[model samples]
Target: MPPAQNTAGPGREVLTSDDIDRALRRIAHEILEANKGPEHLVLLGIPTRGAHLARRLADALERVEGTEVPVGSLDVTMYRDDLRSQPTRAVEPTVVPPGGVDDKVVVLVDDVLYSGRTVRAALDALSDLGRPRAVRLAVLVDRGHRELPVRADYVGKNLPTSTAERVMVRLAEHDGEGTEGVRIAGPAEVAP
Candidate 1:
């Protein structure tokens, strides 16, 4: 395929819509295989785009297993360690499934896995909610920075990048139509 243009604004498209779909499908299959089917599986996406991705994954899982999988949004804003340093962000709602997270395999999904702080915050938030039998992390883009020692259990794409470069994930459900792809912008190209 030809290199994608930055119709979403600036930056070069690294993963097209088709690529993202394929990655999600593969991740869904991997999750099913790892857990030996979707039994007791709960998908909790970190809010904003993560929630949308979780719903998509649930849909994919339903297609494969012919059964519905519980999916919800997890807001980790309050649990973040850098709240004092970074600007305050609006805390989205945290919606757990009917049965809650207790004794289930919880999968936390997100768009970009960058400094690992968000995942760490998510771990803290998940603890406040309930203890799961197991917890796994899934990310659409894994940009290696690693301020913490966290890693994704299922990754859609491993896009190695410098600290100065930014990986942006735009989903139609959250970012509007015709802007559904992963883009990478260097220091000079990134929007302020």
Candidate 2:
């Protein structure tokens, strides 16, 4: 997939920075509560924006529980089923934290949950790492159109959208030099 752009004159903003902050905070709290504190919890964010979100969540969790949570990045490029159809792309570094994922609660973070294909690829990539006690998913936006039997354990927003529409999440950490927000672009406006 192509990189998400911060261009103008296309999608209308659906979420503001404050909204994203609130969502992250809520998600962080939910994660902490669900795990009964951050003990043995490892967060792995799927690149490129997921990694940024993961770091943010880790920071929030640290402030709440007064304990540092391990955060890592998992790149699912090679693991994607559409890789054969799409052009070859660079494989990003898969950074596992100091302690491996063995017997820990692994939460996969991502910007948006659409077709569930990315999450599927992420699961495949994760299997090579180590077995976790449990695996959960957390997404900033859940635009329901699942192709697989996957669901997010924690979601920031449940956006109902047509398959033709595109959900774009912009994070300052990733999009660089822009206001962070979520936008939905129509098929005609989005570049091919």
Using TM-score, give the best candidate's number.
1
Candidate 2 residue runs with Cα over 4 Å from true position = 1-9
Error of 1 at 40 (Å): 0.5
lDDT of 2 by residue, 1-192 (tens): 999785543688888889988899999999999989999999999999999999999998998889999999999999999998885677889999989999999999999999999999999999999999999999999999999999999999999999999998888887775658998998997877
What is the lDDT, from 0 to 100, of the residue 157 in candidate 2? 92
Q: What lDDT tens digits, residue by residue, belong to model 1 across residues 41-86? A: 9999998999999999999999999989999999999899888887
Q: Residue 93 of candidate 2: its Cα lDDT?
A: 99
lDDT of each: 0.93, 0.92
Error in Å for residue 178 of model 2? 2.5
Q: Which pairs in model 1 have colliding backbones?
A: none
Q: After TM-score superposition, what is the CA distance of residue 139 in candidate 1 from its true location, in Å?
A: 0.5
